[model samples]
Every structure is written in structure tokens, then in C-alpha cells.
Target: MGQEMYAMLNQDQRSIADTILASHRTQSTTTADSCFFIDGQGIYVMTVAWTGIAASLLPEGRTVHSRFKLPVPILKTSTSSIRPNNEAPMAPCYALNAVDILLRDIMNIDAPFGGKIMILGGDFRQVLPVIRLANRSELIAASLKSSNLWPYFKVIHLHQNMRTGPGEEEFSKSLIKLGNGELTSNEDDEIELPSSYVPTLCNRTILCPKNEHSLLVNEEALQRLPETEKTYTSVDEVECEDGDDITNYPTEVLNSRTPSGMPPHKLKLKIGAIVMLLRNLDVHQGLCNGI
Candidate 1:
């Protein structure tokens, strides 16, 4: 990781990173190219990278499932194929519990998470475990907060909103209140929006629920724009996985498929065209998703 990115970390993020570092000073693992970091007791500590994308970005990082080999729809009897790890953000409670069980067995310690110093970061208010056909009660039961290991962990509440831009302080505060159900509303439960935000709503952009719709709208808008369109085609490739033949799938076939959150293979653009990012390329430089 860049020193500048580390320097950009706010007080809350610094505290979390510091807590991870303080676990073991003997040695630390890091990837210079990755945008995130988690450090602990040298080679023994298991660091759960935020997502598969984040893991791919890191040199040593791996997803909780990949690192532990935890089964999909993990059960109470499930145990990790490997031993040891910590610092999992946005992991479901059941998943973490499976790790805890594995660690205790490997370390031969009768302690929570085999005496590992864990730092779990995430907002319970947002993106809880998605249990199909599950009710609200079942949803809450699946949360990390409801885990038996929850009491063993010392919770650190981060109050800082690091990504809030200039003049967005009030908007940020409102968001926090909204999440907490503390925002004031009228009898109809409608909170009035600020007049200053009207200009933002007026931007010449149409939100579409699917890629096909977005492509149609984009094409229409591009044709209407008074300029020559510049077409950019991605150098698409197909790298077959182990046990899979390369000839099984053709390049043209792969290019024709546009998965969610991915730009089309043949991207057309015009000057002054509005664009949004689908991935985090350089978070420090603000080239992230939805930029």
C-alpha cells in the first residue's frame, strides 16, 4: 500500500489498523498494489480481505470462504479445511463462528476464537446476511451482533465519515440519522429535502435498473449529442480455469455477455458524456464505484 493512502486514513481507520498492528509487531503482511490493509502476528494470523476483489488486489489476502474453505450455506457442523485468521469485515456471524471453531481446534485453546485478537468492522444497519425466505427475526439472528462470540469482542464504534466531500457534512449527518431512525419526519413520514440538493437532481442522467436499458438510453443520448462518437473496444480475453478447455468458450461469445457491474466490451462515448465507475481503481484518487 502507498504511504500516501495510509496517510489518508482518518482517525477511525487509523485506530482499526493500529489495533490490527498492535496484535503482533514481529512481522506484517501487506501488498503495495492493494487499496486495503490488515496486519497481525506474522504468518500465523489470518486476515480476511473485504471481498474477492479486495483479495485479488492484495498479495496475501483471501476471502473468508477461499481461505477457510467454508461450505456455501455453512452449517453448525461445518469446520474450516484450514486453520487460523482475524479482521473480518462484513462477514456473516455463522461464517465467523465456523472460523472460530476451526481456530480453537488448531490452537488447542479453550477461548473465544482460540485467543485470537479479532477486529470485525461493518455497519449492522446496512447489508446484513441475505437469508433466502428468511424473516426479520431470522435475519437478525444471522448477524455478527447475535453471535455467541459477540460478547467476547470489544466493539469499537467509528464516528468519522471519511468519504464525505466538502459541503456534504449536513447531508452525511442526515444519512446517519436516517440509518438510526432518528431523522425527523412529518405525519406522513416524509422528510423534506433541502433546496440546495435540487441542482444535483437536475443532472442529465437517467437511472436504469438493468444494463440493457442503460445501454439503450446511452446509445440514444450519444446519438443526440452534437459530436462525433468515439468507440473504445476492450481487449477481451478468455483464460480457462483448471480442468476447463480454452476452446470450450470463444472470445466473441464471452465479449457478447455483459454481466452486471461490468462495462460493455464495446464502449461508445462522446465528449461531455456522463459516466459512472463500476469498480474501485484508485480510491485515493476518487476513481471508485459510482464516481
Candidate 2:
């Protein structure tokens, strides 16, 4: 971090950093397992984020999955790959539980994170774990508050809205209320935004619950555009176990598929149509995931 970055931090963030630094200094001087505190076992003060974009913005930050080597298709009994191992922001309860297990096993201490000081941060009102095909009950169950260890952790409240200005405070409060489900909803299960809020085309991005709904919106927008439409189709194929292109899965089947993390086989576009990048090609060049 540079002087400019330090100066950019709000009061709350600065306070958090100062506390972490003080703890790091104390841990560094201690004789008990100094290797784990000072060196390779893990960073004295590590930062973990749920998304790669958030991690990229932080100083020496890494996504939880990469930093912890979390297993794919993680289960109740799942463990990370690292031999030994944060401001773990927006961490799901399951992910935290996995780390708790890892720390206990590696440090040979039957305690939460081997009794190491952890500063967990996140907004429960925001997004939770993304479980495919999961219902509302399942989603709630996966949150950090639902975990048994949630009670052991001390909760600190930071009430100041350091980023919001005087005029914008009410709007910010309304947004918080909306997130917390405190706002009244209509028959459509939607709450009206703040009266002062204005939606602009350039600054707004529409989010849909399902991919098909998104595609529908895109098609409708494309039709309304006063320009010629262009259709591009990707080469569709199914590779067999023997490394041969097989006709067993027809082209229509492949073309009709719109699986998560995959682009549609047939891509449609028009002049002045908005689009989003799905993967990071070069962050330095402004080409990144979710851009």
C-alpha cells in the first residue's frame, strides 16, 4: 500500500488496518510458532474476498478459493488442499467452517481457527453463497449466521456511513433497509426505490434471476434498437471419451444448451447494444471478468 492508498481509506478501514498491524507486530515478536506467524504458514494479516474483482482491488488480496485451495464440490466433510494456512470478507459459513477445520487439523488445536485471531467481515444483507438450484431455506442455511461457530465470534457494529455524504444519507439508509428486507413490498414482491433515486442507462445494469429471462430482455432490447442485427454462431461439437468428435450429441442439442459459465452457441448483437465481458483477458488493459 502507498501513502495515497492509505490516505484514501475511510476512518473505519484505517482503524481496522491499524488493529491488524498491531496484532501482526505482537505475533511477530512472540516465540510460540513464529514460523506460522511470520512466514510460510500464512501471511500475518491476510485479506480474502469472495470475488476475484474485489480481491484484485485490495493490497495483496486473494480470492478465498485460491488462497485456501478450497475443494470443488465442497461438502460437509470437504477439506482444503493447503498443508497450513484474514479479513475474510463476504465468506460463506461453509467456507469458514472448512478453514476452521483446516486450522484445527494443521495446528493440532481443537479450537476455532486454532485459536488464531480472525477478523471476519461481510454484510449479511448482501449476497450469500451461490448454491445452484437451491431454495430460499437452503440459501439461508448456508449463511455465516446459521453456523454454530457464529455465537463464539464477537460482533462489532460500525454504524457510520463513511462513504455517503450529508445529502445522500437517506438514500443510503433506504438501500440498507431494502437489503435487510425491512422495506414494504407490493403484490409483485418488489419495493419502490427511494424517490430521489434516478436510473440512468449508462450507469445501470439489469440483473435477472435466470439466464433465460436475461436472454429475453436482451432480445427485446435488440429488437427495439434502430440498427441491423447480426447473428454469430459458435462451432458446436461433442467430444467423446476417445477424443473423437461424436455425432451422438446432435448440433441442435449443443446449440440449444446455455449452461452456466458458457456463452450461448448463437450470439446476437446490434449497433449500440450493451454487452458485458464474462472472463478476464487482461486486467491491466481494462479487460476483466464482470466488466
Candidate 3:
């Protein structure tokens, strides 16, 4: 085994990825620790938002993404936007700087993968790091750019928005100006929206003040549609070694603990119902997770 490993590590070595798999194939006990300190067994390709990573590090195990362990390798998430709030676990109360903590961890990455690079990227204009009781400046201060470790980072600026289509350069430029702080209205950081952009009908984005308001408005609009309603219920199960535990899941508890953004187990739909996908299964054809 030693000779084989020596040959594997030296002359006839495979890619680092393959070597890791080889170790797993041989049931190397240290493989798990050498990779990560978590039960990353079936979590082959995990993706999480920046704030999701931060929230997972909480000592209290109040992780909104996955069960908390410690010191997992960082990887770019599916979308890799790191745009504040998107899929992140929002924790307003648990104070202390989260971005700083995440950066500090990068600064002290231990051996085996200590040479790993951490790239932090995001647009502050979209959403500042929102702390529970923080003000505007405080929110700004919570961003990774505000951390002491930020000096060591090599910044990369993307001047172009590749997603912008033809005849939308002006619109894209307006967005760039907004992001760069070159464009602003006299109002409280509010910009004028084109009258045509605001949707009074279907097939466009509509901004609402609150979730409840959005839902209520949608419900009202859908009422006018002459489609029959169909209802579906969800199956509830508890994860436990004991077979008996699975059936013991209380409906109330299951419903309460159901993830916030997950499609409800019980769902109602009509023939002409307007439904938005929550995941991007295709990109080339513009079939993505969001809209």
C-alpha cells in the first residue's frame, strides 16, 4: 500500500480529484478529516450563499443552510452572486461581524489546502450586509470589504454586464451608474422607474413592499381567472435511526419547521395558473431558477 501510494503520489499520480476518490475507495479514515471536518459524505457538490456560510459558523447551531460543523472548504455557490439576502440565512439578532468572521477564517486556512484561494465578490449597491439593528453605515461596515483581511485580497472589477441584450445598453449603463454611485435621485436613494416597466398586467417583474402584500395581490389577481383550483398535500417524515420516529412527525411541527422558501407540500394550482420556477435547470434557453 505504501509503495502504491508512493507511486500514486509521485510518478503515476492521478488528478487531485481522482486521488481523493481513490482514498475514499480504499476507505481511508483520514480522508474525511483531510477534506473537511463535517459529514460531507453525500454532500458531493454543495453550494451556499456567502451569508449562508457565515450563518452556518454560528456556535449555537442556528444554521439556516445546513447542520453546522466546522471549517468546511469554501466553494462558489450555484449562482455565485453573493448578493446580500438572496438565498442567505438572515440573522438580525446574532450580532458580531459575519463577513469579518468569514474573512478571518480564510486568513487562517490550515494545511492540506492552506494554499486555497478565497475570492470575495459582490455589488454593495444591490444590498448592503444587513445586521438586525444596524444603520446604513453599520451595514456597510459589515461587508467583507470593510474587514481587516480585505487588504490581502486582489480585487477584480467587471465593467460589463454580459446578461444585457442588444438595445439594452442604455438600461445596462443606467444600472452600472446606479451600482457605481454615479446615478441617484433626490429622494431617499430611490430612482425613478419607467412607467411602462411597472406591471399592471402579466409578464413582468412587480416590486412589492412586503411578502404578505405580494401574496395577497397575487391571490386577488388570480381570483379573476376562470380556472379550477387543485390542491395537493405534502408527505411529512422525520429523520432518525429508529423506524418508529419517522411516523411520529406531528403535522403542526412539520408544517412549522418546513423551510421558509420551499414549495409548500400542500399546493393549489389551476390550468391557467402563473407559476415561477425556483431553480435553474437550464440556462441557454433562459430557463433558470428565478423567473
Candidate 4:
């Protein structure tokens, strides 16, 4: 969508789009999943992975001459009629935000006629837009507040998760944590070590010390288990990959007490329990026997 629109923009407009697009593309591989809005310039760009229907909807390509230029309005609204209060006058307004205009004029006709619009893009976790918002929430909030027509607008939530795998999941999680100021490491705590100390070669050296420490700890724990028979019984040994044996100590422990009115045999129970019962007089009085 953005690419087609970019081709129609004038030289100055193209320059602005190029600048914004370049900045986003250089950041990370995920840069492709970003949307851009140039305020005052009235230029917006969105990129999504190829969709046949969307491509078909785009205007047919034509040769570009110096005379060719982008449309003044991406979408234009029809003139509204006035009803007398006896005939109260109503104004025809167009949605400036492209997504809002697209949805109102195209996708969902039953959507509101005019109002402030909240456009949200979650491209960071999905396909990056051709142009990305520098600050998403702030820009959306500002756009919504700018219009007083309906005073309020519907919030459009873009739901798509394109990133997969544990590494990508962890990266997204870290981004969310950082946004909420819950990042584990503080800026001041980060230390710069001498370049020579950095490990360039990754192999057994990385695991050796840590593996030895784990083995020693396991051995010490196993040695103490036999003497503590009253608390622990039957220590089973399992070999681990790092030359360490995991000692599993099993002991019978009392889990829970019987319910107040339930008999011992009838009481369904377990250790670390919580029980809930549904409402019905014919049943066990809406109480959970064991939870």
C-alpha cells in the first residue's frame, strides 16, 4: 500500500518518505514491520506482506511524468444532507487518518461517519510498515484528540504475531519489559570490560567451570540425603549431560485435611489442595471437595 502511494508522491514528498523509510530499515531486520506518519506533511505509509486482494485494489500503474502526483485526499467523503431542527445544518467531514478513512469509506460502511480516530499498529511483532511511527502511542493519542467532531473515536487494534521461536519471543518480551521500566539490568550496572578478556571462541571453556560447580553441589546434596532418612528416603540418581548426576529424593508427605461435612472415604483430596463446587442442592452443596 505504501509503496504504491510512494510512487505517486512528488519529488519533495518522495524525499521525506525515503528519509523516514531509510531510518527504519537500518535499525533492525524487524524494521519492515513499522508504519510511518508525517504530521503537517499529511503523508502516511504502511507496509504489509503481499496480499493479493490488497494489490488488486490499488490503482493501475501508469508511466510517471513530471506532471504525475499523489492524490490530494486518499479518500473523499460524500456531502451530507442537513435536517431542519426544523432543518439543522450538518457539515461533511473527511477522515484525515488513512486507516480510518479506508475503514469508514471501504471496509466497514456501518462504522462511524466522522470522529477522532485512534490508529494502532503492532508491526513490531508482525510485518513492518514502509513508514514507522517514531512514537506510536503518543502519535495516536494526538491524532484522536485533534478532532472535536464526534469527540471520541473507535480504537482499531491490529492483531498479528508474525515473529516465532523462543529467541524472537524472548526479544519481544524484553522489549515489553523495557517499555514498562521492568528491565532486569540497570544502565549504570552495565560494565565495559577490557577487549582481551572477551571470549571470542565459544566451546567447552564456557561450560567447564559451571559444570564442575553443579557436580560438586549435587555430590554434597547426595551425601547428606542418606543421613536425613527421617525427612528424605530413596535417593534416585539420574545422569545429566554435563557429567553431573541429579539426585531425586522422594518422601511421602501429608497433603490435605478432609472437608468439614464430608466423610473420609467420600472426600476427594490431594496435597496442596483447593476445591470448588458448583451450585446445586442435589450435588455436594456447591463445595469443592479438594482443590
Please rank every candidate by TM-score, starting with the best: 2, 1, 3, 4
RMSD of each: 9.0, 6.3, 13.9, 25.6
Which model, 1 or 2, shows the larger lDDT? 2
Query: Which residue segments of model 2 deviate by more than 4 Å?
Result: 1-44, 83-90, 105-110, 201-213, 216-236, 239-248, 266-288
Q: Count steric clashes of candidate 2.
A: 0
Lowest lDDT block of 10, candidate 2? 33-42
| TM-score of every model versus the real structure | 0.55, 0.69, 0.45, 0.22
Off by over 4 Å in 4: 1-120, 123-141, 144-160, 184-291
Superposed by TM-score, candidate 3 places the C-alpha of residue 86 at a distance from the truth, in angstroms, of 11
Top candidate on TM-score is 2
Which candidate ranks first by lDDT, i.e. highest? 2
Cα lDDT tens digits, model 3, 75-134, are: 222111111122231222122123334433554643222322222234555655445576
Model 1 weakest 10-residue run by lDDT: 27-36
Q: Name the weakest run of 10 consecutive residues (lDDT summed) in model 4.
A: 82-91
Clashing residue pairs for model 3: 279-289, 280-289
Candidate 2 structure quality by residue, lDDT tens digits, 1-291: 456777887776676556555555574323232222111023446666666676566556666777788876666677877711132324557787888788778877766676566666656666677788989998788777787767665554556777688788888888788877899999999876653576564357688999999888888888999999898999987767864446567889889999877778888888898776675455445444555
Question: Residue by residue across 1-291, what tens digits does model 1's lDDT show?
Answer: 456776888888778667656554532222111122232213354545435544544445556776678886676577787722233435667887887788678878766666655555556555666667989998788777787876655555678776789998998888777878897899999987666756667555488998889889878888899988888888877665753766777788888988866888888888888887765465445454455
Q: Point out the higher-scoring one by lDDT: 2 or 4.
A: 2
Clashes per candidate (backbone, < 3 Å): 3, 0, 2, 20
Q: What's model 3's overall lDDT?
A: 0.44
What lDDT does the true structure give each of the candidates?
0.65, 0.66, 0.44, 0.32
Candidate 1 lands at a TM-score of 0.55
